[model samples]
Target: MDELVRWLGVQLDADKARAAQWHDLECSIHEHQEGGLLKAVAALEVYGEVPGAVCDCGGPARVLREIDAGRQLLALHLPTPYQDEGDRWPGCTTCSWRDEMDDLQVRYPCKTVRLLALPYADRPGYREEWRP
Candidate 1:
């Protein structure tokens, strides 16, 4: 459970860094062109906007929004320590979903967290068991 949490944190950090890089690239392009290309393209209204046009660039924004959503899900579904007799087990606070095998409440790093981590499956330390 601790490892999974760390892995998710690393993935989120990597995503944030990528989003920042994309945003910097967009800013550099806009600064270099001074919106001249965007203005001309908007005037034509044929392509509406270039694939990464500064006028309608949503690449970084979209990625950042997705990151925000992932963060929100992580915040909501947290690892809670529950004492069962003399032992402690990690459980999910917001995960009320039942497991198909036994119809019992899912454990920590539940399906929601697993789904959120799906995009980073290729990253190091991601286990196949984490799949939803």
Candidate 2:
């Protein structure tokens, strides 16, 4: 697999993990009666700087929604191998637009995927070149 494709997958996986963690926390808080300690933990601004901080103001439902959206977007922009002049290149499934001059398909990890990965840029394993 291409390095960029691998990197994008890692980023998306990281997002899912974070969302799962938040959902678990939310569930625990709701299920248990920890009193002030749980309230204080929930009130903390740990995720304040993170994009799409659904856990801050909403419950597990919101975090699940975000996770579903990410999954759908990733599904739409999957990396596919295509043949061009006897050589195979990675291309995007949903980005079928052709370049005017080259008439070639958009490369894998297309603009949509790049933008999807943008929110997790602060996380580890993010590359500067991956910015859209």
Lowest lDDT block of 10, candidate 1: 23-32
Q: Model 1 compared with the native: what TM-score?
A: 0.66
Question: What TM-score, over all chains together, does every model reach?
Answer: 0.66, 0.59
After superposition, which runs of candidate 2 have C-alpha atoms over 4 Å from their true positions?
23-56, 86-88, 99-102
Please provide, for model 2 over 85-120, each residue's C-alpha lDDT reduced to its tens digit, 9 standing for 90 to 100.
753566788895567765657776788888877887
- Candidate 2 clashes between residue pairs 3 or more apart in a chain or in different chains: none
Local distance difference test, candidate 2: 0.64
